[model samples]
Target: MLRGVCTALAAVSATGALMACRSPHEPAPLTVRVDAGSVRGIAKGEARQFLGIPYAQPPTGALRWTLPREPRPWSGVKDVGKPGKDCAQGSPGPKNPSSEDCLYVNVTAPREHHGSLPVMVWLHGGGFTQGSGKDYDAVRLATEGKAVVVTVNYRLGMFGYLGLPGLAGSGDFGFADQIAALRWARRNASAFGGDPRNVTVFGQSAGAMSTCALLTSPAARGLFDKAVISSGSCGLRWPAGGLFPGAPADRPYVPVAQGQDDGLAAAEELDCTGAGALACLRGKTTAELLPHSPSFADHLAYGTRLLPRDPAVALRAGAFAHVPVLIGGTRDEARSFVAGAIQYDPELITARTYPRLLKEAFGRHAGRVAARYPLSRFPSAGLAWATVLTDASWACSTLAGARDLAARTTVYSYEFADEDAPNVNGLHVPDVPQGAAHATDLPYLFDLGGRDLLVNRERKGLARTMVGYWSAFARTGDPNHRGAPRWRPGTAPLSLAPGAIRTVDAAAEHDCGFWATTAR
Candidate 1:
């Protein structure tokens, strides 16, 4: 078997750990003992899936707004065949129920036991507001990639990210949970036939944003060796009305003081003010605090012990962890956002309102911006506005951040350019053809919502190619091997599509030079 011979030699690490090969006479075990307890997972096709093992204690009551602690040990074998409830969310849908006791990690590995296989840890994307590690099925990533893949569930919204004044772990409870997951991975990976030393942390959307925070956070040092950031670089910024019609100009993170102020506001609204506000807030039921959750959506704070400054600033000053990075976003990244805005108010942005929208976003540079991205080039006003945001806010910011990372460390930037990419977003507009928008690249790598989004053979082939690229990257820092085209890091991204994968001149294509002058 491949695990017995080929992987035996490949499993050798710098520290000279024991070989990851299974002895020919030894049988694979159905149950494994981890730090917490013995867990028995199911055999999922060609992979072993251990689902919903707690890495941290539940952050309920006195634990709210505090750093994560190691899980209390158990005495008996735990059945981890199914996922736990996702962290308590602001919006718990019929399909996606959640709870506060949701700090679980799911592990998927090739069925054949290989002790030294590379590790890929996935952090899910839901705007730091909602999402669970269970939402992504990583069996393919584990079996095909020949790696151990772990998807994590961290606290979400106010439950995970409250920055009360004088609080100890202000604005970093969520990030702390991620670090704790890494700690668990490091401690238990070898038992799962994974190389803890060769872990690569990757995520999309707000998960990607958290990965950005992970790179810049002092407390997260040595947790992982490589990073894959998708769609949510620290440098990504939305101008006023760029995200949606009335959305404010913002980045994912805020100042600590700002977060504290929002926290206090929540306290006053809930009538939990004064010296014991933290305790009072903690004592409130989850239902009582759900409404104020959205306010902390993009409010991960800086100037705290976890993150000293903005990750964008940290990258510019070369203060981030010196790890190889794979970063980029989809081509038409903002069509989904604009499409949603138009869905709410069909007349919110027509030909008549497009110019006014530009003025509100770009201010003095509105005319120049209009001239550069004219309505004649696009199908509808919403599509045109989406293009403006795709270029100015999404593409350019990602490219610039990639450039910064390449200057400091190795970077392989890519743009998932399949125009007919699957719409994993689940938001549809008759006018907006979701062509490679935002998280459309996700399904190419992960089976999102526990279902494969790729339907056709060509897209499935592209998914295979992407898995090859990603798994190879997980195996080694560089994502290059035979049978795939060469991927080089530079200012622009390597375009990822079904048949025509190649390099692209993104600055010229996106009018980044014009936005460079106009951007605030």
Candidate 2:
């Protein structure tokens, strides 16, 4: 069997460093010994699942504001067959049920093992507000890809993110949680039939932004060999005296010409102030802190010491991790963001709102980008509006990130344009058809357990095609092979626009001119 050959090779290379093999038992169940304790996971047909393993101590009570501490080891083999309680959150739908003690990682491995398979660590996205790894099931990723799949949960919102003056260091805790999880995998994954040397960190939306942040963070170097960033890419924008876009790089770190909001004053407005700020925050419950969590305009994912001032700046300066990367976004990434951006009114999208929105999001280049993406070019103003938003925020950032990495890393870019693919969320309205909107490609990556999402009949091939590409990438840096169309790595993205998906080679895709003309 494929697994037998791989395990034999692995055993030979490992020199019996791991647990002793069966004196010949009927395919021993996949298991591992982690720092927290030992876990014996069950194998379901083809997938081996180990759920709810803590990567760090529960950050509850006095432990709230401090960096994560190592989880205490357990005395016996814990039954991690089921997931732990999702972090104490606000609500179920809009906001997840989150708690201060939420820090866990779930691992799934293929039943049959090739000694140490590549491990893919996933970070779920919810604007850093709501989302849980528990919502995702990794059975398919493990079996089909012949890889080890790990999903993690980190602190969120006020419990995970509120940056107060006398508290912990600026911006991170959540990212640090991710790093801790990776460290655990580095030390223990081998026992679970995974390669410690070959790790890939991948995520979407805020998760993707977090992964990109890891590329430049000093704390995360050498933890992974490759990265995959989908959708949201972040940078600094300001609203107050605190860190904002345009704050002078020398004294204060922020992006230029981005915005002019008083960040510190705004945090103060949210009641995050003073020396005991951390202590006060720790005393508050998840429910009490919900209202204070930044949303809409106040939400800032970039601009902080942890994020290193500016990602693009660091990337251009070649100050980021030199690793293989796959960066891309859906064709209509902003339709979901539109619910909040336009106050739920699709009709509000116009030449006026379009330009204003651009200005609010991109500063000076707003008008130029508005001109380049005038609503007159599309069937409806709403369509054009959505296009511009997705292209500028998701597509543009994705391509630019790839371009920046091109100098020191192998960068491959793509755009998901499977029009018939079903929208993954119920937010789709009569006015807005969620054509390959954000995260629509996720179900294609994993089995999604039992959750059903849009998958057109003909497009089923596309999902398999994507999984093949992704699994190949996890094993090897390059994402090209048989069973899928030839893919070429380039500084620019290979367009998935409309009908035929074209692989852009040495020549730049339309993105080069799109970004150049859009940038003032």
Best by lDDT: 1
CA deviation > 4 Å runs, candidate 1: 1-21, 24-28, 92-96
Alpha-carbon RMSD to native, per candidate: 3.8, 5.6
Q: How many angstroms is residue 3 displaced in model 1 relative to the true structure, after the best TM-score fit?
A: 17
Cα error of candidate 1 at position 450, Å: 2.2
lDDT of 2 at 51: 84
Tens digits of per-residue lDDT, candidate 2, 1-520, equal 6568658767554322343343332354655667666787777667778888888999888887567888898977888887776765556345454566679888888666466688889988776766778777877667777788899998766555545444454345676788888887787777667888999999987788778778887778999999998875543222211112122211112332121133244345557556655565566666666665543122333455456546657777888999999888787776655533344554455556555555655567767766776777776555666665555445665666677788888888888776656657657554457777877777777555446453455565666667677778988988775866777887655555334567653123224456656432
Q: What lDDT score belongs to each candidate, Candidate 1 first?
A: 0.86, 0.66
Error of 2 at 504 (Å): 4.6
Off by over 4 Å in 2: 1-31, 92-96, 234-273, 295-306, 339-343, 350-371, 452-457, 495-501, 504-514, 517-520
Clashes of 1: 1
